[model samples]
Target chain A: MKILLIEDELELATSVLDFLKSEHYLVELASDFPTAYEKAIVYEYDCLIVDINLPGGGTGLDVIRALKKLHPESAVIIISARNGVEDRIVGLDLGADDYLTKPFHLSELNARLKALLRRRHFGGSSDIVFHEIKIKPAERNVYIKENLLDLTPKEYDLLLYFLSNQHHVLRRESIAEHLLGDDADQMDDFNFIYSHIKNLRKKLIDRGCLDYVKAVYGIGYKFTDKK
Target chain B: MKLLHQTQRLFFRGVLPVFIAAGIVSFFTLRWVFDHETDEKLLGVQAEIESYVRINDTLPTFFQTVFDRWYAEPMPTGSMTNLKAYTFSDTMLFNKFENEIEPFRQLRFPVKMRGQIWMVSALTSTVEHHDLVLILAVLLVTMFGLLLLVMLWVNRIVSRQVWQPFFETLEKMRRFRLADHALLTLPPSSVEEIQELNTTLENLAYQVRQDYQTVKKFTENASHELQTPLAIIQGKVEILLQNDTLSETQAQQINIIGQSTRRMVRLNQSLLLLSKIENNQFLERKPVALKPLLEKRLVWLEDFIAEKKLELETILVEISLEINPFLAETLMTNLLTNAVKHNIQGGFLRVILNENYLIVENSAALPEASVKDLTARFARGNPHSEGVGLGLAMVVEICEQQGFGLEISFEQGIWRVQLRFRK
Candidate 1:
């Protein structure tokens, strides 16, 4: 996927760019508003991740508007430093697909971006396929070698999240947020992630599938097939 | 009493005594002067009769008007020495002309005639000062009543007109609120005191609004600034975690840092939400079926309940409330989650929801220390729990802002939280 990143903060931009590049996405960074505007108008990208607070005589909202007019097919996600709902409402009203407040997990952002793309681009054949496991997102079904694998809703979501960002360490916090949304706040819920991961691993192993879910040392989990 | 009515009542009370006292003094003064003149006229009538008898050598019986009568009685043989010269008395006389008894002031005087003194008595029946005094009293009272009525009428008109601007200012002040961002407005007035009051209030309102804006801006900018730095730290740490070159100690250190960073983020977001709720920024309302909402929320708590082996009993009726969905979710999520989080293993959790209130009662594990001030900030039920401790605080804030009643208490190791929708 080709994504245009509009950000003025060099440090945060570097981390995001490195993360996205490692995820094998063709990413371009526009550090200022004028350059972002020109690039957004000139080229067609599959997705545009625009920071709402940009420098150089313009805001990222204007760029999203102009890019959306030129290429209505391009997906847009707004990242704002403001936690206020007014700006989020305005951005959403102006045709942005999603809004992420600053200090967000890159993994969370990637999950949202993948979900938006899947809903937008793959509405007809919304299937996520791996080596042995295949998922029909529209039907909320998963199959292994023409045999249905009975999975709970949370387990299915966990497997899909791992598939979306394979080989990257997914923190327990990010997983909880993805699964629970606003209900993730105000308490520690590490036990739920642990129990769910254990059950999912057991179910898959019993079905003679390779263990793709790996737990990092004192960190979180990663999906990798390498020995 | 209304201000105008109270003033009128005080003035009415003050004016009555002076009016009564003035009428009494005037009546007495008129009566005293009238009596002196009547006495002089009676003596003069007696002198004329004596002069006529002496000059003509007989009693003068020429003529008499209808209201006047006179008589000459011969003095007794030697009784003239006992009666000095003159005597006067008021008598009731029966007049054949008028049938009713008439009051007469009479005087008796001695007239020497042929060595025997002729005693003469003159009576005047036209003494009408009693009726005159009564007429004067009635006139005085009538004038006082007219004066009081005119004063009351004038006072009513004056107060209604003059206090108009003050009432208008009061109404405008009552309607002024910071949430609407409307400036205070006042109607102009010609009265100096009222005009000054309006200006002062307008100035005060302007100052209050300016201060409010400043506080609001500061909160937004502060949150923004803090969030950016925290984002940078969080992003850098997230990127650093992707590497596979860290020692065990380093990994542990990073894990600690990450945990603290996430906790900070939650704290920041919670504080911001609290401020927004207090500012009355969330005013959108929609009718919601609370039974389904709570049922769904309870499903999210299934994992936690199963983990602690809690027994949750929920009795939700079909109750509809007009509220912002975000607030309802927050309040319920906090209450439901806290109940489960703090409960004992195999303990009972009972949630009863009716039209009036929502009650959540749960048994606790090792809750010997009384959890006082549960809704205060950072006052956790468990001192070592991983919560940021603003959960119940946020619930309390939303309840207060939305005019809901909240009662939280811990008794005999059972914690109960009651949220009342109706007062």
Candidate 2:
């Protein structure tokens, strides 16, 4: 998906740019207020990542408000070091689809961006039809031959990770680390991972879906299509 | 700080004194007028009686002549002493004379002639004169009542009218919140002092609002400008990390960039949050159920509670108060976070909730310092402490904005933060 990230912090902007580019998103960056404002008005983006503090003539909030007025179809996400609930609320009030505070990991931003994209553009339907099973990103809706199945947000994220990384042996530690982010290291156990996998497996089985989420046991869970 | 409050105080301070002084002066003046009028009337009566005595043999002869002339009959000899002995009659002279000297009660004259005392009393003493005196007393009382009413009414009207512009200036100042337009529009008044006051307050409010706006804009611009370069530098480091030729030392450099970037991000966040609070952007308020929300937050912090090895105590009562829910939550969170964040490993968290008040007390490892600066942004006891200092400041802002009262006290090394809701 095409996205524009308007931020004044060079390092943060570049880091975000690199991450999105690596993720194969068509990403464009603007380091100052006027440049970003000019670019936003000129080009139509699927989504916009804006920072509240902007350089040059205009504010990030102003940009959001102006852009939303111009392009109502495009989803907007506010990324700011302003962790004040007031700022978040104001951004939200100004038609931002989501707000992410600074000091956030790229993965978390990506997750939030993906969530917003799905909600704004894809009607929040994260269902990927792969032969016999359909996977929904949000609502954790899983369907096999037209039968619906329930999955939690985390469980759904985990399944999507597996699907994206099919044919690869996902390490348990890496999976846990990625799933919980910085908070994973504080925990003494990863048993919750196994329990989630088991539940997903059972739910799929009960729904009469094929066994694709294979466990590496000591390592991680993987999704493989052997048809 | 509000204009209304300031004016009310000023009314007590400035204009109130003037009214009180005026009232004291008027009171003395009224007493003097009454005394002078009474003295003049008494002297006049004494002069007229002395002249009548000089003109006639005695009061009895004078009274008897008047009786004969007015009623065409010789009065009984002792009837003059018993002035009230006459029967009832309807006449205008009696009414006019009664009205004129009605207040004079006992100014009778006793004459000595041929070694016999002729005790001559007023013919109208028990009837006409008594009634006249009663009417005069009533007239005096009525005059006094009218004077008092006029004085009070005039006092109220004058005080109110004179202070009208003052109150208007106060109202304009009151409506000046940080979020709204700060340009003050003071009402014009005829009084020089009041006009001067309005102009001065108008200027002050305008200056304050202007300064606030400038600072707000600066904060917004500064943070925005800083983010881009920081983002770019971080991005470049990541790009370098993707190179296979990078050594451990180089990787460490990238890691440093990452850490500092994180810190910058946090610092920027705190700055922005503080600015927002100062700007009063989050002022939307509504009634929120306090008990359930507090319970839920405490439940979420159960993990942190477990890690700290602190004992949790709750004494929440069901109460609902009007406030911004988010700010209320932030206020509670900051209190809890500070309590937990600063506490000793095996310390205790004591939470007490009563009607219109909530108190959170916790034990800390660091010795208690004066918590007077608790509500100031970045005013932590320890500079290196993890807290951003905006927590309590935000709490204070929310409390002020929502009309809630906040009190902070340290007792026996226990830092106590109390939130008192306006009853």
Candidate 3:
């Protein structure tokens, strides 16, 4: 899938670009408003990630407006530091699909992006299957070979998040943020994440499924079909 | 006191003494004029009798009957040396109607008739003591009545008209609120002092509102600007944590960095919320039921409470409050989180909701000093706890903005927070 990221902050843009690239998606960057406007008008993409406050004296809402007019089929998500409720309403009203506040976890962003794409391009399918593992997104139920695996709500969410970014290394902080959002900030320690991951892995391995969950040495965990 | 009543008080205070003094002085002056006129008439009568004696060379027969007394006696040799001597004295005379003695004013003088030295005495009609007192009393009463009428006019009509502008300005001030953004428009006045006061107050209110807006804007801009960079730092740390070649110790250190970055994000968000509340941004209000909201929050916090192995008891009465819905939610979340976060291991947490108030109590470690400090920003009872310390401060702010009463106290090793809703 092709994704266009319009952001003025080079460092944040680079981090986002690298993360998305590691997921094996084709990503392009537009560092200013005019460039973003030019590129958005010139080509069509599967998804558009736009920041509200763009450089060159224009807003991302204007970009979304222009893009919707030119390519009405494109999906748009607004990422902004201005987390005012009014801004969120305005963005959604302007035909954008989602709004994400800044200082958010990249993993959470990735999850939301996948959910949006799944709804837009995949006919709103709720079932996700990977070899022996099957997930019904609507019911939040997971199964291996037609046998149900009981999982806590948090564990199920964590597993789905891991499956979306199969090979990318998932940091503990990112996992915690995906699970708890801002509430994770109140936790004095990140040790609870380790237990949740361990339980999820055990539940899968006991269900006659290959263990795709891998520990990235001193960092965190990863799920991949690769050896 | 009300401004109008205060003015009346001062007016009466000043006018009452002057009225009494003037009445007394005028009463005495009238009495002196009456006595002086009576003396002049008696002297005229004596002079006329002496001239008649000189012109006709015989006493007038009508003089003795008309006057109280017309007596001519041989003057003593020493008294005759001075041709004329006049004297006035008060004397008593019998009244035939009432058959009682009455006071009189008598005049005595020396006269010469046909070169014969003679003494003449005359008494005017008796001037009753009671009549003199009654006249003075009437004069005093009349003066007092006039003064009362003037005072009443000034207090009720004149002063009210004069102070109308001042009272109007006072009323406007009483209704003014900084959050309403309504500028004070004082009524136009011709009085210089009232106009000056209104101008000064208007300028002061304008300056205060300007300063408040500037500060609010600064807080919003600063928070907005800091968010992106903080996001960048947090993202970089997350990326670094994914490196497989990093040592365990280095990974631990990076994990600490990530945790602190998350804390900073929470702190920044809390600060932004506080500023928004101070700016009165949450103006929408509705009646919210407390029982359901508290129950929902408790379910959300079940994990935290279980983690601490704390016993939880909730006694929620059916009560509804008028408040901003979002603020009410925030208040409940913060209070419940504080109760669970600060409680001791294996301790008890109690929540009680009633018609007038909501109380949250929890078993805690012995307080260092006082619970009053807990309501202030960054005042944490346990320094090692992970809370950002803005929770209770936000609760206090919401309470003040909503006109709810808040009190925090610690007793018997339990910390209790009570919020009283205005009826």
List each candidate's DockQ score. 0.53, 0.12, 0.41
Q: Report each candidate's C-alpha RMSD, comma-separated, in the order given.
A: 7.1, 14.5, 5.1
Model 2 chain A: which ten-residue window has the lowest total lDDT?
A: A181-190
Candidate 2, residue B248: lDDT? 55
Candidate 1 chain A weakest lDDT stretch, 10 residues: A181-190
Clashing pairs in 3: none
Q: Which stretches of candidate 1 lie over 4 Å from their true place?
A: A84-86, A118-127, B1-217, B365-372
Q: What are the TM-scores, per candidate, against the unseen true structure?
A: 0.68, 0.52, 0.78
DockQ of 1: 0.53
**Best candidate, TM-score-wise?**
3
The digit string of per-residue lDDT tens for model 1 on B1-423 reads 988889889988898888889889988888877766776888888778778777877888747765678888898888877886788788888877878788887888888887788888887773477788889889988998899899899988998888878888888888887655678889989999999999999899999889987887677667657887788888877777777787767766776787788888888787777767767778898887888878887898888888888887988899989888888888888888888888888898899999999999999765534555667887776777888888888898888767798888887778888989965
**Sort by TM-score, top down from the best:** 3, 1, 2
Pull out the clashing pairs in model 1: none
Better of 2 and 3 by lDDT: 3
True contacts kept of 3: 0.53
Alpha carbon deviation, residue A138, candidate 1 (Å)? 3.6
Which portions of model 2 show Cα errors greater than 4 Å?
A1-14, A21-104, A112-227, B1-194, B233-250
Worst 10 residues of 2 chain B by lDDT: B65-74
Cand. 3 TM to true fold:
0.78
